[model samples]
Target: MWHLAKAPDLADMEVMAHEMFALLPEGFRKLCEGLIIRVDDFPTDEVLEELQAETEFDLLGLFQGVGLPFQSGEVSGQMPNMIWLYRRPILDYWAEHDETLGHIVRHVLVHEIGHHFGLSDDDMEAIEAQVTDEAAEMPLGAPARSG
Candidate 1:
């Protein structure tokens, strides 16, 4: 049977995601509540079926379930909002792109968590711009990288 090589453990991904999140402005993390971050090597066949993916390499991250805005009255127990980062896909992206691994991880984290809060690409861009502006306000000699 064909199988993939070893990947980063779940704990490591969680820690990596959190570290990237912390680097964002304080308010950004607060906006996403009960959003669970999960990491897996590639999307499962079930996910491919659900997402109508034609190939395994088609996805890097996925946000499962609905966002908060759509909820109405009388909501009972339900699954928490979740973002899945496909490890192999991310590693593939890393290899394909010239960006640093930390930046790629941060990009994945931001986009996936961005979905949890119902943020659009434009919205994410604005947030990114704001973070960039804030970082520029730091000490003159020392500069903070966007990663």
Candidate 2:
């Protein structure tokens, strides 16, 4: 089992996020080099307002950034890719479902990042099969299970 460091005022969700990131294959990691992963207790008022979320826990994860395939040679400056993991909803999911925490984090992480790359479910599943110990044992990380 993977373990995260313990620190004061630290949200375990962040640790889970990091662990999930580490579990991704190196090939996938190389594809999302500048992607930012963040974890918060819940979506802020501003974020909620923008997403038009009906509740704080409505969203589990989000991807906000320019997809690489969309960029062209003329591109000079562009925004970075980012993935946000919602802690409250994640915790709620773990509590309500039969899945494990690690699995949940990986699922959310993969869905948000993998979807951005336009990867298909079959592709993700194939990759997951190649790295079963990392993907299957941890569970989640697929588009449908993301968050």
Candidate 3:
């Protein structure tokens, strides 16, 4: 018999995102060296408007800033790339799906970053396969009680 803990909060989800990033293939991770990962309960009104989201749950993750392929020596002081994971939306997704929370987080992370890098569908699929396998062996830690 196994005991499962409560659902993760924003902080816990952030940690999961970091772990998932670290577990990606070295070459893929190298491309995202300075990438930032963040978690929020919901996208801000500003962000939602910018992305043309129909609802708060519509966006699970987002990639911001210039992608590597678009970088040029002519441009300077560009903002570092960042990935945002929406916790409430993700949790809602988890509740409705048959997959683990870790799997969902990893999927969102890879999909956002992969697109930013202009990776092909096959490339993303390979990364997804690896992440799913690794996440299965990893424990979904007991999240702290949200205040």
Candidate 4:
């Protein structure tokens, strides 16, 4: 089974992120109405420089744009808030740790979404716990798809 296993690619991670997002509490999901989620192999050079990351693997995921609490009225050309999941780094971390890929993806998703809500680490942890509990209750099968 190990020999047959392959690391998830960008599209796979994107689906995982969306599935994880769907697993989150309904109210929490509602708060993320206009949020966009994307996955890439790694952080871009500009992103690494701007975040002062020592390497592409240094950042697992990122939340870009102003958080809800900081938003004033809409600007003329403001970009929608986005969460970027660095696939390679996330895979690297998964290989080094004992956690499952789904767990790690859920974590990164929650953390970035937390930033969108201007939530603290503690708040995110609570949300993670809720998601974990809810997910465990769900029957094992295909992940929920977003339309």
TM-score of each: 0.73, 0.74, 0.86, 0.89
Which candidate number maximizes TM-score? 4
lDDT per residue, candidate 2, 45-139, as tens digits?
A: 99899989999988899988877687565556776788998887877787799876677777788878777789888777665554444443442
Of 2 and 3, the candidate ahead on lDDT is 3
- 10 residues in a row with least lDDT, candidate 3: 138-147
Q: 1-147, model 3: which lDDT tens digit per residue?
A: 237667777777888888777777777888887899999999999999998999999999999988889877646777878999999999999999998777888889889999988998888989877654545346646332211
Model 1 lDDT, residue 67, Cα? 65
Backbone clashes (count) for model 1: 0
* Deviation in Å, model 4, residue 85 alpha carbon: 0.1
Error of 4 at 48 (Å): 0.4
Across 1-147, the per-residue lDDT of candidate 4 in tens digits comes to 889878877887887788888887777788787899999999999999998999999999999987878888868799988999999999999999987788888899899889767899998888788766445333334566432
lDDT of each: 0.68, 0.71, 0.82, 0.83
Q: In candidate 1, which residue ranges exceed 4 Å CA deviation? A: 1-10, 130-147
Off by over 4 Å in 2: 1-10, 73-77, 130-147
Q: How would you order the candidates by TM-score, starting with the best?
A: 4, 3, 2, 1
After aligning candidate 1 to the native by TM-score, how far in Å is the CA of 49 from where it should be?
A: 1.4
